[model samples]
Target: MRIALLTEGVHPYAQRAGGGWCRRLVEGLAEHEFQLHLLAGDGGGSGGGGGAGEGPATYGPATYELAMWGRRPAGRGPAAHRRRAYVRAYRELVRALVLPGERGSFASGLYRLAELTRQDGALPAFLASGHAQRVLEREWRAPGADTAAGQPLVRDVLVAGDLLEQCLRPLSAPWYGPGPGRLGAVDLCHVVGGGPAALPALVAKRLHGVPFVVTEHGLHLREQYRSYRSAPYRWPVRALLLSFFRLLTEETYREAAVLTPGSAYDQQWQQRCGADPARTRVVHEGTEAVGREAAGVEPEQPVLVWAGALEPGRDADLMLHAYARVRAELPGARLLVYGEESAPGYLDHCKAIAERLELGEGVRFAGLPESTAQAWAAGTVVVFTGLTQRSPRLLADAMLSGRAVISTEVGVAREVVGPSGLLVPPRDPAALAGACLALLRDEERRARFGLAGRLRAQERFAVAPVVTAFREIYLELVSHWPAFPAVDGADGGVPRPFARPAEYWVAGAMAEAH
Candidate 1:
């Protein structure tokens, strides 16, 4: 079967992000024809050095890359009549954005704009034009629009217009059409990421009869909300762009044939975003399971392992403070931090924090581990201190390695840890320290937790089960393909699945006869 895998970010194309699960999915299902659609660089944050490792050593031939900020080629510009429609569409789109009462116009306005872009092919130019800014200004100043916070200045309108154009670029992509080698020809459109990455899949399903599956490892809309809080945009720009993302994500969730959240935590977010409970599935992100032999051997010292990128959100400071308390009680206890700095100078910042806490030789920064098993084997208990960790792959790796875990009660920690380990509230050093001390003091408890954790990882998070689930999902969606509701004009209606009988009355009759 032909499958189109749409994703956002530099994963698979770059060595960053641990080779990414996309590569694994494609490799696991090598018998099927897979086409990759990647959107690079979306979060408009400024950072130095390409962050992590070099480009991927082997990017498959099926990959298609599009940069979020790539320049659009100059067009002769749309005809005069078409220009008016573009202006009206932009007006409606911005209207839906700024006014809460007009939220229902979002989907209609969005697809109308997409149709205009698909027909004329100058969406970026149109968005960057003065016309787009005027629409945004008028919408903001319109009656019922929420301008009580503050009126948007000229610069704010321009910035918001540019952002909107960048996000909507996928709608103008040439990947659609019913011809072979295009998205329409694919047996299924699988969106590997949420938000803008799903934009292409949305377009494909809208233009063609193809069904799309959305697999969300993290809640993209939630991430957008958090990121925009720290973003350098003005309030007006933030408000407008956030609304666009909010509405777009909701439309994606509502339209998806199936919503596969990487964990139960993310599944809740999907439902809150309007995903149908009957259509939603929780698929845990998988990792290679470590052998029992590797997990059975414990480190001699009472060591605590913290593995993750050394970024501000990871709250390394809290971990240091908690470890300081642990050292006071058990002077022999050690804290080993593994992984490199994701945000520049975060490593030095953590080191300075350790100094302030006066955690002498008890705390040590070990660079990236050669392998996950080695990292988990180097310590008796694994620790996580992030304020927000969506997938928490290292937590799974620790469980797979048969090591006891103590994680912040965030993201998938509760679901992943279950009864195998301990959980502490985020940013609470006293609670974290208490949990660590409890585990370190009791070797029997740690051993029992480790064994249980290993078993849980093997049963739940192993790669084979995850692949099998998708294999079945793909077939299930395609098996009922031709029943997809026909796409209505520009303002596409929500596609409904073919109805199934609530009760198998025919089979019931057969059973009654028997």
Candidate 2:
């Protein structure tokens, strides 16, 4: 069985994000064969360091660049130290973003980004290496580059555009392969990341009879909203950019033969944004269930653990506000905020909130909680404060560690926690605080809830069940009906899938014998 593992910022790239899940997915279903179709991006923001442009082909010994982001020179390091490589990658990335609807959308995008690469390099190198000076040099004075002034102004506005493009480079990549001209062959395009990644999947499914699958582990548009909204851009531009992510998300969901969101929170968003519920499934993020044997946390006081990006959507500040109330009730209580400062002003916000709530004493920002079990082990209760409910893995780990949870009413928390843990409405610090205080006061009740959550996590969130479900879905989609079989066209090119247009599966299925 041929599978096109369509992904963005994962796989071949050594990152702990969506790529990890794709690797596990492939490893799980080793029984099936896979061919990757990638839309690459830099690991940290440069243009071409990405393994995405090519990947090692799986059908015997074949070589290709996998989808990734970054360009550190084709040669080895210690010479020139990646200064020029990033400049070249950024030129290409900028070129890709600037060109629009000039016959080929993807091609137009490719050239724009490529030109940037030739100028200042890719996004990852630019950000990781701290070479914004080069961006200034090229943005205003490239030989063929367009600038408002005869000389580089270094205006704040231009800097804003530069930053916006820098952030979006990952969201915008040459699909199918390194560039628009090349698209690999695959049975289906399984988009590991949505939004920009999904756009290419739609194109692939249309150009070929490629069955498209979308797996959203982290919501792309949600991240984009956070990006454009808080970006230095003013109101109008932010709204417009967010709209782009929204539209792409809708189109991606519409094109997918199956839309598997990593959590129930994502599933709702997909439907809200126009995905067909029939085509959607909530495939919780898989875990090994190793926590049962690993660590067991026994915090002295009623400890609350919140580990994730300290950002707006996660609402760490609000959690702090609630914690102030909890401390009033339980003075010896402790809180561990795990995760790096992802958004600007977010870490400050958490600190200020902690100060105002006057619970700043024992609250520590534990970066990237060594392990889910370690994070969960620190708390008698794991709490989530976001209004956005994606799969609450924080709770899953807590449950697995035998810790009760206190989460806001958003995402799969209600479904996962049910009657086991205290649930509060999101953004309401009073309610969140009150729940924490209640849970702290009742040790026996907290232990019971923890036990229930642990049972549920072990029973449902285990990886095997998830792999089996996906295997069945794949078999059903394939054997339930035959898709395009290879056929040659008049020009000797292989005509796209089976024998008809790819739309037939969706359209023809609607009218068949019903």
Candidate 3:
């Protein structure tokens, strides 16, 4: 398939755990030809609105850069009138979302920008603006809301609408190409997630006749709102900013040809936002294989561990709060955190909570490791209370390496953890503390849960199966497109999936090979 792999900022530049899944899709679907269009947050910077859509992308034996975001340019560039027009339109649309009463002008402005972009070569000047950040702020503080909806209705809708217009620079991006130095041609519009990456896809579907498929790893826009809650912006401003995403998600559900949430829980939320049940698929994120003998790994002590980015939403703070309580019952208990940090102050916030609880010595800040499963195998019990409503589950291999997982019943925790693990509600440290204490007290049960989780990860979320499934999707998409483009020798037409004889791996022998 000449797939236009639409992404926000993960590709071209390396982001720790962010680009893994998209890379998997690109590599696994080797049978299908793909045209990559990576995007990065303008971060309101001065970078090219478009990138060269060269030839076939190169992939190493294991990793490929998933172009998610475009890099910001170093200096200020010239602004174009065409770009300014789009900014106005987008801002107005955002104002409409946050403050519905501004509909008349916002609607009028949005269509005008869309109409302009539909013209031949009209995207460049608009996508070249440096005012995106300003636009974002402008709309957050913009106008009228329904008093009863309990959402946001700040100062003036027109001002906010203008701000959104400036921020909607990507709509003017030349990358959404009908030519070279553009997004290129593709059989399907495959969006990696629904935040910044999916935003471009939404526009492409609206402006072009492209068919879009959405596969959400997590709820991107929701996480953004949660992170911004404590920002310097007024509460009313935060409330208003949320309307931007609620509306973005709504658009995603409507335009996407198919919606695939990484977990069933994500699927449910997509439904709430108006996704058709038949179009939504629950495809779990699979783990890259690490060659290690996992059939037998000994858990020596009563330890609790959590693995994931140290972000606000990971619920790391809640885990720290719970650990303080757990240690009262078992003074020797330890909580180890192994993952990179995210968000400006989230890591420090978690550490502060640990210090305040006086549970300093009982915790382990084991830093992120290359092999998440190896890190997970070190624990006797895994304490997973991070917010599940939006965060994607940890690599299935890590979860399966077993430590009794105690997660909030969000996303696919119930399905992933199944009966072998304990479940808890989010934000409840007391319940989390109790679950950790139970697993810490029982060594044999921990061993069983770990093995069961390992087996399940192998059976359900392993890399091979994910590759197989995606290869199929690629073939289906490619079959519909006549041929690949001429750039860099990409032979289009039907890039066949299952084109070669399959190689099978028997159980125990597999981990050793990985």
Give each model a TM-score. Answer: 0.84, 0.67, 0.70
Judging by lDDT against the true structure, name the best candidate. Answer: 1
lDDT of 2 by residue, 1-514 (tens): 5566655554221222565566667878887766554444434322353333334332221112333433333322212655465455444433322223211233333334444443343443443343544553453354543332244444543443444444344333333332222233455656776765565556555444557778887677766765554466455344434544565566567667898888777777778888898998888788766345634647766678887787787888787887777777778888888888877888988787777666757798878866777788777778888767665566677677777788887768887788878888888989888888888888788778877877778877888878898897877675544454432223245544433434676687888957
Clashes of each: 0, 69, 32
True-structure RMSD for candidate 1: 6.7
Roughly what TM-score does model 1 have, to 2 decimal places?
Answer: 0.84
Ranking under TM-score, best-scoring first? 1, 3, 2
Which number leads on TM-score?
1
Off by over 4 Å in 2: 10-16, 42-63, 66-185, 232-243, 289-294, 343-368, 481-483, 487-514
What C-alpha lDDT, on a 0 to 100 scale, does residue 53 get in candidate 3?
Answer: 28
Segments in model 3 whose C-alpha atoms lie over 4 Å from true places: 10-18, 42-49, 53-95, 98-111, 118-166, 176-184, 199-203, 206-208, 231-241, 290-292, 307-371, 387-389, 395-397, 425-434, 474-514
Report the alpha-carbon TM-score of model 2 versus the true structure: 0.67
Over 1-514, each residue of candidate 1 has an lDDT whose tens digit, in order, gives: 7788887764221222323588778778887787776666642221111122232445452555555654543555566888899888888888888899988888888888778888878777888887777888888888778653878898887777777877887777666665434676666888877878788888877777678999877777887887787678888787887788899999998889999998888888888888899999998888755444545577788999998888988998889999999999999999999988978999999999899888888888999989877888899899999898787577887888888999999878899889999999999999999999999999999989988988888888778888999998887777655543333322154322231222444567889999
lDDT of each: 0.78, 0.61, 0.60
After TM-score superposition, the amount by which residue 469's alpha carbon in candidate 3 deviates from its true location, in angstroms, is 3.0
